[model samples]
Target: MYTELNSILNTTPDSFTQGEFILVSDRQSDASFLMHHFLSFYLRARCKVCFLGLVQSFSHYNAVGQRLGVSLVQAKEKGQLIFFEGLKESLSVLISQESNTKSQAIDFLRDPSVGLRSLYEFVRCTVSSSSGGGEKGADGAEEWGPPVLLVDDLSVLLSLGVTVGTVLDFSHYCRATVCSQLQGNMVMLTRCDGEEEADDGDDEGSERLHRGLTHQCSLTLHVQGLPTGYCRDIHGQVEVCWRRRQGDGQHTQKKLFQYKVHDKGASFFARGTSSAVL
Candidate 1:
């Protein structure tokens, strides 16, 4: 089921295991495309997926899933897919004009603590519910597999005034909790050049967040966008690096690949190999 992705990782059957944090870094647009590939792979593999979308609307994701041949509606109906509407929640809070204190606009601009807390709570609830037979299953037994938690663009929280420390703590907590308790895999997407585009304080915060998450995560995937107008046939490049915590703590050699986006989905290949354009 995950043949394409497994081929990119050069892994044999039963070699790919869940229960670790995987970080995907890229430009905003490219990151979104790569995320679709990852999510489609897991969903097709019959793993439960909880998608927390902060960068794009739910409709955008639904369209992308459809193009990838993933039936998001069916997944949800089968109790294998759940979505946390981060964008919708933020927009609702920002546009609300009911009886409040000072100004609704100013309140929206303050901090993202409220939103962050809500997100954390939602994740906790979803994880807890999926553990037992809280949701229906195919057979009489509970459909319990290692769930995949995907968060699109963690930088959105930072842009909404979430402190670096808070974000780091939240990430660590989620990774530990999900990997240890639920025995699931957690994937987070972030911008590669965030530190370069922010102010001094934000720059430092972004750098710290990057370093901390890099150390905490078991695997990291870096996506580099091709030079503008340089390669019409290629979409982008990726590097997958991983380390084992149980062994000597040594890192594995990085694997490189290039991908092409098509109507169906993204296809990965060796860096220099030529794939027929779809």
Candidate 2:
């Protein structure tokens, strides 16, 4: 596929083409490659590009926003201008950009427009800031915007001109936000299955002991330091449990697992999958 795409790209003598440009990013780094390619194509095409695919890092968005002088606050103020009012406006913007021969389509696919709208709804639904519709208290104090995800206290965000609305919107779809704990702690676990055989088998009693179970499970933990602002080592772990064969001719078991997160790396041991609090 790479070779074929390259060949087609090389065959196009004209730098700018009228047809739609589609780029697929299979992984996070692929997104970076896509950005690099779009910039290269944009130079030749000189067209406004509508980005698609996942913008993995807020850093990427910040980089682009800095280039365009568009911050979260600015986006809110220039909402309709940048992202269009809704999906209709978003599609309209893309179509308009597509019409320009010099424009390049750089669609990053988080559905930013949709994400923003959902966030707006969540704010109205959850927190009662401006987006939520409820006014401030009698003292004129207002509820601060979205909670910040940081390794340390994020008072800086407030001074950085980040509003509750912007923070609420940003954190809505952030996986890190969902898993993170107070004081910047986080734990991530994945479930896996494996099979094993008993040492004794063949005998009726042994056969019962050696009967192979088709389904087995294990858990892997990916732990990182809280709010480091980068993927860094962390040190922390809590008890975990696993259960199997519960009720109605099913086996059941549970265990405790501990893990630690450090700046340089992390460590863990496999344990059964039962719910546990550490």
Candidate 3:
């Protein structure tokens, strides 16, 4: 699916595993394009995906997928993709009467819950059901592989009034659940807001949250817009830094790339060449 990108990450087909947690940080404007590239890679690899789109509608994702020739609708129909409907859930309190009639509604508003519990439950159930009472292969191994869990933006929860500590706890719980219960991988996209004043406590708090999650992640990728002005033929310039966990500790690598946005889709390439590395 993404041979060069996987090579950059030092992943080999024989050595691939599902336990890693990847955290991608970028400015809000550039994050969407990068996320689409990342998700397309996994989806093309035939990995089942559970997507939690916090900042965008499912239709937006589907449109992007179509442009990229990923056929997200077909993936969903084949039970290879599951969307959690984060946009709908976030607005549920305001638009739906079902919540008002149930005790869940009161808890939803009063508590700082980011709705991770429900998502976790859903993933658990889906995995279990997919197993079909523990279907086995010839050698007594599981017939199916672990799924990939993708969360569009964690900062959306913070914007919705979820505390940093609560969000961290929820993230940790999700990581643990995926690794231990589902044997899957998790990829989370979050914004690194650089606009806040240096002395602002909220800014400090946001930085702390970003650092906290970066520390927990097995791989951390930082995307920054290039300083040069945009060109007619270029969508934008971006520098990507990848830090991966190694046996001894952590190792860092980086690359500079430019992207082009076309009417149908977008593509990224290493600087000065057509070779794509992201």
Best by TM-score: 1
| CA-lDDT, candidates in order | 0.70, 0.27, 0.66
Question: lDDT by residue for model 2 over 85-177, one digit each (tens)?
Answer: 223333544566544442122221133333234433432222222223224456653333222111111112223343434433343332232
Worst 10 residues of 2 by lDDT: 182-191
Tell me which of candidates 1 and 3 scores higher on lDDT. 1
lDDT of the structure predicted as candidate 1:
0.70
lDDT (Cα) of model 2: 0.27
Q: Tens digit of lDDT per residue, candidate 1, span 102-211?
A: 22322323466643454566676677677766466557634746677898978666777877777787787788667778888888987755424454644545556766
**TM-scores of the candidates in the order shown:** 0.81, 0.20, 0.77
User: RMSD, model 2, all Cα superposed?
Assistant: 22.9
Model 1 clashing residue pairs (backbone) = none
| Root-mean-square deviation of candidate 3 | 4.8
Please list the residue runs of candidate 1 whose C-alpha ends up more than 4 Å from where it truly belongs after superposition: 10-15, 27-29, 97-110, 113-115, 134-142, 194-202, 227-229, 245-250, 275-278
Model 1 lowest lDDT segment of ten: 101-110
lDDT by residue (140-244, candidate 3, tens digit) is: 543445667788888877777777787687788778777556777788888877643443655535566778888788777666555565456666655555555
TM value for model 2: 0.20
